[model samples]
Target: MRRVLAGLVAGALLALAGCTAESPKTDDGAAAPTGPPCLPAASAAASPGPAPSSAGKPLPAMAVRCFDGGRYVDVAQLGNAPTILNLWRSNCEPCRTELPAFQRFVTSAGSKVRVVGVIVMDSRPAAQSVIDDKQLTFPMLEDRDQQFSIALSQVVGRSVASALPATLFIAPGGRIVYTYQGIALDDEKIRALTAAHLGIEVAA
Candidate 1:
């Protein structure tokens, strides 16, 4: 009986020692209190917030290259007109689906706003073929280097890694009034937003 009691006492002491051994240690070999690590004040302050909207302010000076009629042109000479710049590629399915609706929107938008298409990630022949096949009657800009896409992505606070079929509605003063990313743009949505923002009724 005494031996059994001794064994029990020894086992209890060993278990207690094991538990203490598992406790975290500090730099000086003292027991370290356990909780979340401390974060710097700057790190706490630097926590990301909601992304800024493109319409929040006027656009910074940007060099936009575009294809007009059958020639390449610079946006700097395009003068001050409210413009809707659409980024698309021939292989993008959403782009293909949204083109017709966009064409309709452009036709109805009239001279109040200019709708420019920037073709990216596509061969010249492929992009031209799509334009020809669709009978698109708007100014198209070739972005073989994707510079326009990168610039727009930075403006909209989005990653450049994201796919195309993006739209940016720039106000007369060069402020981005509306930015639509992903998903096919609807005719009704575009018309309503344009009318409300630009004070022009888009014909259905």
Candidate 2:
């Protein structure tokens, strides 16, 4: 009973903070299934599958799926700008709030920072539903097997933590300078984090 109450409290706090909950499961005790249908896309600029070679190391040489382009591409080939890779899923509660904020940040940041979205812990349809609902026009990818999440958790502290709604700040040479472990990362926090850690000042 105490454990259940603790979990409920934690969930409520996470929802308030706009963070993904831990290990969402289904009725059959399986992983949570996809959410809903993806809305019509506004542009044709999504990326394809990116299989990261090193989960927790510098930018992994991987290939991710792109929805708009309808093909796969190498993650290292995404572009040269310092990147902000955000992991999310359709079924994630906090993702409902965080993704839109990320979209706004991407639009305002322009070419100054490379912002990419990677769908985690969800089916393509469900993840697409969140994208469509949020009207996000950023680059999207997928990590269906949770390899990146495991790798990242190992790197951070050897704890098996889910990487959904997490943000990785990669420097120019693909060095991951910092990783935001919390939810509720808005434009202001993103800008401050980049400047403080990545040394790049993002203008308002």
Candidate 3:
């Protein structure tokens, strides 16, 4: 119990400060890692369906990389379909609780909407462990420098909260229809938001 509380506290601190835990290096001074690769976003070329009302501010022009040291992903191009982008950390209790629900949502969502995750201010190994344990198959990006947070603040026209489990609902043209911060969402809430903001209905 004490360890769990300590982990929670550490996660909160990391989220608020945008700090990363030191990654262990190998004998040859290279990083040795484990776990599956963070998958890429679905094909932007394939049209999910008709576009939603692209009335909101576009996501900031920035590029983030896959969590498994894979290719860079353009943040602004994520709106090939309606999207739910979630920011989380491994040590965060709420994130741990919420990610499985997201996985479930993605499993049930089919091609109607896309769900993406970003590991904010956390080490790749730490984040990967959670992903592996949860069996999460959604595409994940990494925000090591907090550029994503800064960009998000610009979109909101203010300093957004430095909190774990932030969610962004994006439209077809990369427009952000809604942003939910400082709260962990469940499958039901995720579906409701998708329907409300992106006009994509996912069954509960």
Candidate 4:
């Protein structure tokens, strides 16, 4: 009787451990992303431009690592396409709300524009969990040391490093056309902004 009880307890403990452990695979047996499986930054590289100013400008010459341990994405080199750079953090409640809207926009817009997410001042695992939970597959970069933030602030001509959920609309020439800060953006707003700033139209 004692042996059977011990065996049952051990089995229960093992089952609990199995339930509690973070699995590398999801329910469908597909390997789950340990980090944000962001797409690689655009390959078309632009020559390094002058520093950004308050007026419409290019992304500051800064390099940040892709979350998936891919190549260092040069900020200035993203001028190959019209890009939307979204800044987010895992701990921000509004970021949680707005990320899905961005995902929807990505689906609706298709290749009309480029959407990139930058996770600032957040741990890779925490950001990865959010991306997994949200099913977000946008190109993502990590600004763990806040280098991108300072560069962004310089580009926008304001101290925007600590702000969560900011969006910058950049033209193909790498000039920043608009900067949206503080508010959480939905699909309609994203579309409107894209149309207004980047001059790209999508269905209403």
Decide which is better by TM-score, 1 or 4: 4
lDDT tens digits, residue span 1-204, model 2: 999999999999989676454555433355543432122233223322222223335666666555443345566654345678788777777767788878888778776666777777677567767777788887776666777666656655542236457888766555566788676687788889978765667677
Q: Which scores greater on lDDT, model 2 or model 4?
A: 4
Tens-digit per-residue lDDT, 1-204, candidate 3: 999999999989988676455564433354644544444454754446655555989888887877655467787668677788888889889999999999999889887788888888888678878988999888787787788878888897765437677888888888888888756788888888888888777886
Worst 10 residues of 1 by lDDT: 35-44
What is each predicted model's overall lDDT from 0 to 1? Answer: 0.63, 0.64, 0.77, 0.78
True-vs-predicted CA distance for residue 171, candidate 4, Å: 0.4
State TM-scores per candidate: 0.64, 0.65, 0.78, 0.75
The TM-score leader among the candidates is 3
**What is candidate 4's CA lDDT for residue 21?**
93
Residue-level lDDT of model 4, residues 50-103, one tens digit each, is: 333344777787677777764577776567677888999999888899999988
Model 1 steric clash pairs: none
C-alpha lDDT of candidate 2 relative to the true structure: 0.64
C-alpha positional error of residue 61 in candidate 3 after TM-score superposition, expressed in Å = 1.1
| Clash count per candidate | 0, 12, 0, 0
